[model samples]
Target: MKKAEEVRRLERDRIKNNIVVTSTDAKGKSHEDIIHAEQIGTKIITSELENTAGKERVMKNKHKQLQERIFINNKLTWEEREKRKKMKQRMEEEKKKGRTANMGYQKITIDGKQWK
Candidate 1:
């Protein structure tokens, strides 16, 4: 009985250590509230990643527009610029949304908590 209980305790610890939990407050605020023994390697944070990616996208767009206005726009006629811009806008609107068929998370929930 003692050995079996010890084994179960250890397994529980292992599982707890492998999981991370986040919490949110009522005023639309969120934070990572719990993590049991921290993992050895890098952990990819979803919100931080999205924020960084958004900033990068804005910077890239600004640079592209600047380059186009400084170089390409000067050489092209007004009609040509509007044509290219309209075509890009149409293609952007037609772009696909959401994930591919096979994309998913391999996570599971335990007692209302998520585990990866």
Candidate 2:
């Protein structure tokens, strides 16, 4: 049989082990009463792929730079802008040529689901 002090200590330890934490997500939504180390619960915080987010951030920066160059930067002469456009076009064409020359085909199809 357990002593009275041991029973009280066990109850106190159980209460201390059950921890609750609240947190907010990227969308400014607040989560409440998030119990720790439980089987059933809502996600207190969300996660995303860093590479995907980095790609989106890079695209946004590129678009902003292009817009600034085309509209805001008046120091660039019209001829200079035209030259830049032509150079971009040439680069695009080169990329297309490279793609056509060596289009990679999947040879190892055994792990189809893993690839997918």
What TM-score does prediction 2 earn? 0.22
> Candidate 2 residues 15-116, lDDT tens each?
432322223221222223223233223423222213434334433444453433321111223344565566555545656666322111211122122111
Choose the strongest candidate by TM-score. 2
Question: Cα lDDT for residue 17, model 2?
Answer: 23
| Candidate 2 error regions (>4 Å) | 1-74, 99-116
Clashes of each: 0, 0
lDDT of each: 0.34, 0.34
Model 1, total clashes: 0
- Cα lDDT for residue 21, candidate 2: 22
Q: Which pairs clash in model 2? A: none
For candidate 1, the lDDT comes to 0.34
Considering only N, C-alpha and C atoms within 3 Å, which residue pairs clash in candidate 1? Answer: none
Report the C-alpha lDDT of model 1 over 11-56, residue by residue, as the tens digit: 6443322222122311212324322222222421112212334334
